[model samples]
Target: MSSPAHAIYSSTLSLSLQGHAFHPQYGVQLIFNEIAESLILCGAICSQNPSCRTFDYDSSSHRCRLFEADLTNGAIIAAASQTSIVGSVILSASLYASMYNQSCSACQENRYQTCSSTTNTCQCPGNSYWNGSMCPLQLFENAACSQIDACRSDLNLSCIINSYGGFTQCLIGINLFTIFVYENTKIVQIETMSDYASLRSNDGVVSPNYNFLFDENILE
Candidate 1:
């Protein structure tokens, strides 16, 4: 009866090797007794056991000790012969960077391909864009786009016909500000505005009384 968040949290579990040895008084559950030859084998042993969460491997004696849970109650000490192996999947702020780094690998079989830690998948380089199954050539900013989907949506760009040349170009729309004088009078100053609001101008109280255009929707 695990929640969706719990299922997501459980997937990040991994095995890592710590430099120091586990505490002597930690009292491991002893899943396998003195049979592990290498640290990798010890990790495999821990993975097989349902209760094993952490383990300590002794390089000198080849003593493999497995713990049922985390070793918060135990203290880590400096030991040259023993190596501690942790099977922690618990999500915490301190372990976020390590977990993120562990999630990334040389994109499946391709070493040159980009790897996304969030999706945990291989992706094309900057020159290409993902097209459902595979990545295709990415459209440049000024490239001609005849179709609506020709432009790259990730770059916040769109394809439209140019005003001056009448050619389709991948471009981004920007707000333009222009000043216009109404009735050719120095008493009033006005500028073009958009859907938000217009800036009010003060002309030193010189009212040259002219007809003003007001929209009822603007007041509302």
Candidate 2:
């Protein structure tokens, strides 16, 4: 079967940036007596069952394995086989509260997180934030981040493109890193402080290390 174009996530958060998302070296040892045609189908089947936290789908044999472990410490990402698909259950807000009743009884998460018997939700108790795998002390400024939801909202942070355009980081507001007004031939030298330093704590003005002569149109 073909994978679905979109998804409705779930509460089974097997996310761990520190390492593989979940499963021990022995792996998520329990295989559900279930089979799925695709990875998405395995997740869909997990969504229907409240006790499921993560699933591994083997495309070669169509095996849908499930897990219910204390995720205080997160796991790394790897496949039992090249054809295996692994994932956690990160549900959406709309369907979130519905998963309050039933979930895994085992709490393998780190000290910062706790499993609420009544709500069936594992949560970080204080200022610490959950970074997919385990709860960290705090979210720092300029930290590498992939999603806006992963950043600390109380600090009014957003994930934006970085200077090199290679990765994203948590910066204040929707601030664009830098802008170069490319002129066709005019080489207007900017004898000014560094452009990006404005957002830094020491105020806007920082010394430039070196200057580059513009030669965008010049041929070899």
Candidate 3:
């Protein structure tokens, strides 16, 4: 009878290897070896494993390193041709177990809402009434000014008088009552109600009792 023929196991770098297992998600592979067969086997293992991000193979030891996360490629390995053939299969069941556990946990609540990580928090916009991330309850309440008239300067009431050559006064409807004149002060006290009414009404009539002479030559 002929000697039993040796079964040659084909190696591949693709993720479709038979009987290969890996994380369920988010995995890749990095290859570091120059050997064609080793590269092929590493790729095949990673292809079969869903969560294997990459694979690293040391040619010096014919060792295959598998990672469940991202890996750096193009790592140089010397004396790769002299290394002995080691076992083909190496498995780590707890690969990336800690990462999965941490990602699944909930973060603490942020009071200011400014936490930008996976945690949900409340943050305030710029120029808002509140100083911090959260808006205050009494922000912008009972403001001193309104949108229509901020300073309350538009009173709309004015006064005109016949004295001092038809002088006009701006009557600002505020708490104070005052008057101003451009000329020198000339006192003419009104003792009767008729004199006061004539000055107040601005009817263009000068009272005879309060008459004062002015020099005509002063105009020139």
Candidate 4:
């Protein structure tokens, strides 16, 4: 149906945590039937049910659980063979039509504003190099990043540990191999502290080597 001129609806489809599952206590159980066949179907069910907000699907079990709200009270822990489906409503066919026609001037009004088809409004686009409040600029080496995905991955950019002990910038990762060698003492220890560790990359920053630490408790 056609909405009012310039009418905006806001919603988004999030696949960011697709492979993970939400905690059981977070969402309300609306239904647990064979009717919920797939994640797509679960989303549709949520849309149909006005009270539904989020849903979780067990791919292996083919079980679907719809929630009246999102993950607010509990943590969304990762689960094997589970997929979480979160969707927003604020979309209309008219918005898609407008985007296709290129009649959307919302983006042109400002350099930071991009047409959000789901919301039918002009807002910052995803992965546009986040600014303080809005993402108007592209991220460069050493630029602050809230999450790993916030930085450009196509350029082999990685959000790793900074000297400050916090993830703040995007830097190129250095590849290093840790081979076990028998020294005169015959003791095996991980070591990357060498003069070669200070090699400069395109960003003129020292590449950090990461070594995997073995934990005996993990075997349990």
lDDT scores in order: 0.42, 0.43, 0.29, 0.41
Q: Give the Å shift of residue 216 in candidate 3.
A: 87
- Model 4 spans > 4 angstroms off: 1-11, 24-35, 82-220
Q: Order of all candidates by TM-score, from best down to worst?
A: 2, 4, 1, 3
Q: Candidate 2: lDDT of 50?
A: 44
Question: After best superposition, candidate 3 residue 81: deviation in angstroms?
Answer: 11
- Please, what are the lDDT tens digits per residue for candidate 3 over residues 83-133? 432212222322222221122221122111122233122222111112112
lDDT by residue for model 1 over 71-147, one digit each (tens)? 43344456665354444423333322223212335333321234654345444434333333333334546777642
The numbered model that scores best in TM-score is 2
Q: Tell me each candidate's TM-score.
A: 0.30, 0.32, 0.19, 0.31
* Candidate 4 residue-wise lDDT, 1-220, digit = tens: 2133322222333543566655544222333335466767765565545334456666667677655334432345677764544343332333332332132464443222355464444443443432223332234456676433344454555454443434567665532223232334443332232211111111122223322232222110
Better of 1 and 4 by TM-score: 4
Query: Could you tell which candidate, 2 or 4, scores higher by lDDT?
Result: 2
Native-vs-model 1 lDDT?
0.42
